[model samples]
Target: MPQVFKDFAILFKYRNFLELCFAVLVSMLGFGLIIPLLPIYAREMGASGVYLGLLTSLFGMTRSITSIPGGVLADKIGRKKMMVGGLAVYTVVMFLFGVSTHLYHLLILRACQGAASGVVWPVAATAVADIVDPKDRGKAMGFFSMMWDAGIAVGPVLGGLAAAAFSMAAPFFVCSALSLASALLILKRVKETHKKSEEKPTVSLEGLSFHKLSLIGICVTGFTVSFAMGVVHPILPLFGNEVIGLNEASIGIIFGAMGVTRFLVKPISGALADNIGKKRVIVTGLAFNGVFTTLISFSESFTTIMLPSVARAVGLGMTMPSINALVTSMTTKEKRGRVMGIFSTSRNTGLVMGPLLGGFAFDALSVRAPFFICGFVVFMGALVLIATVTEVENENAEIALS
Candidate 1:
């Protein structure tokens, strides 16, 4: 126990880690503030059916398109530079979201927002990977995840209140301000993790030979989970409002409940992944998420909906840290940014497809159809992971570089 405290003390001693956590928290706060409200805003702008899904997918598509390039730039230029630029873009785009008068305006702005996110998330993840020891990566990532979830937990309730009290545009303005503040914090407090190098790190298939198969498996799982999420994202608010008869505030509470569950569970799951095995925790989480996400469709009331959302949060908390740590374990520090970029791309791919498919399903079949299909997709991903992925320890990770 004393040693554990000491370890945590040492981890916190890194100034960059603390700053990164702060940045992520603030940025996610802004992001969460807007996410639940975006679809409604679009619907109000006369977007429906496939257009609604396209609105969500455009953001993901742009992000997915830019992620690899952003990763390469992070490795080439630096993490801090990429992050600063991304935040600047976020500030502009979010404010634009406030004044968006048409579906086309939203489509353009969301695409830009995705591009900014492409730069921010993968690079920040790499920065975290750089600062922490390999053995403690899961815990470090868990802490980071906790911060993000914490922001997400609080943002929606506040956003909901602000929107109800004022107007739909209010949250976007507030989020823009928050994003600017986060950017300033990054510029002032966070140091560049990637050092300037004359000889660039070789990023080839050969370098990843040791864990190529595992990486592919992880990416596949990432896609599945994200795709499932995407399928639900655009329609959840609508479902709550139309089907479950929930108000904006009530819907916000449900979203907050999920975030709260993730915030509370991530640290514990991270510790478990480190002490037990990542694969075990990941498999368990995936199964839980698959089951509960499907159950969400059957929910008739706000209370019933919260149960599955909370359960899904637990599943995500368990899966995320382990997957992040696993990916980091499979690659060298120099190539970490690009590897993370690939991982982000995989997630974005699902993000892109999910809403598109969900929109179609929502229009064609039933509001419940997307949920059932998404649940099945996640189940298949879990099966693939169980069959193909093997746990790679921190001790063995160094050998992968050779």
Candidate 2:
């Protein structure tokens, strides 16, 4: 209620948070600009279903491999530097994607993109955790997620139109420009937030404490949810274009609607997580997502699909911020980057496998098979959360920019 608004108000008081939001928004805009068209573009280059899946999985593979190491660098070296370097890489990769004439070029570029993401996304998340009070972490993360989703929502529409009006490569060129802008913005405006840890930076899995168990639980949940989404990612555009006969612009609009729904839901969900139980919010939202995702498999047309698509967005909006807030609550500032990196690595590992599974299912099974399997997996993730995660109320003093 009023308390949520107050917490949100408190977030705006921090310059670092605002700067980070702006940078992320623009960068994600760049992401949105080309990602929806990527599958179709690959297909145009003579890729088959399994090959397209590999193309998507390759990005996840490189990102998964790099995420833990990137996090350690962020912890030991600095968050801002890691972010800046990653964005610079992203800018270069996006530009290269524009000029790429073959599928192999895309594969190389995707690997680079994944590596950059491994550095940028976790470090940026760690920075978000670092800048806010634990009490306000949920709302801040919601806001952060919302900003990027906003960029994603608009990007597809513009990209679709760009592809229609000019060329498929047009949107990618724009993406590169936006990525460059984002990198400069971060380098200039964002401050260093990592407090030099007295202990050496290292990741381990040997602990039996409540906090450690909870971290493991959240990681499992993150992996499951991301796996579900990953299963849908490579095939969703193909389904829309091939089955429903939607043009690129039309497909863009559908994804845009989904993104908009997620963008709107995140801040509210974050606030609710702060007030109601985080686990309660997470389980409920995930259940909603799981049901709707299953329903999407039954869709026969664009009209039938849109409802479930938006509903799925609502579930994701609720789940991600709460998950992030919970993770932030579990760690101290000194180790936050590495911990976020671990979570990202876990999620990316799922991403690595999901598309492969999805591609196999799509190629070998019914067209609806991937969606059904993904839906079941998502529902199971909700149950896993209920069984495993125990919410700990963080009582640490809030860190601030001096």
TM-score of each: 0.96, 0.96
RMSD values for the candidates in order, in angstroms, are 1.9, 2.5
Off by over 4 Å in 1: 1-11, 200-204, 399-402
lDDT of 1 by residue, 211-319 (tens): 7888888989999988988998798888888789998888888888888899888888887788888889899999998899899999999888889889988998898
Q: Residue 395, candidate 2: how far off, in angstroms?
A: 1.6
Q: Which segments of model 2 are wrong by more than 4 Å? A: 1-8, 206-210, 396-402
* lDDT minimum window of 10 residues, candidate 2: 393-402
What would the TM-score be for candidate 2 when compared with the true structure? 0.96
The deviation in Å at residue 336 for candidate 2 is 0.9
| Global lDDT of model 1 | 0.86
lDDT of each: 0.86, 0.86
Error of 1 at 90 (Å): 0.2
lDDT of 2 by residue, 1-402 (tens): 665466567457776898899899999998998878999999999988888888888888999888999988888888999999999999999999999999999999998999999999888988988878777778888899988899999999899999999999999999999999999999998889876556676888533123777888889998999888888888888888888778999888888898899888888888888888688889988888888988888888888878888898899888998998888777667777777888898899888888988888888997788899889988888888888888977754223211
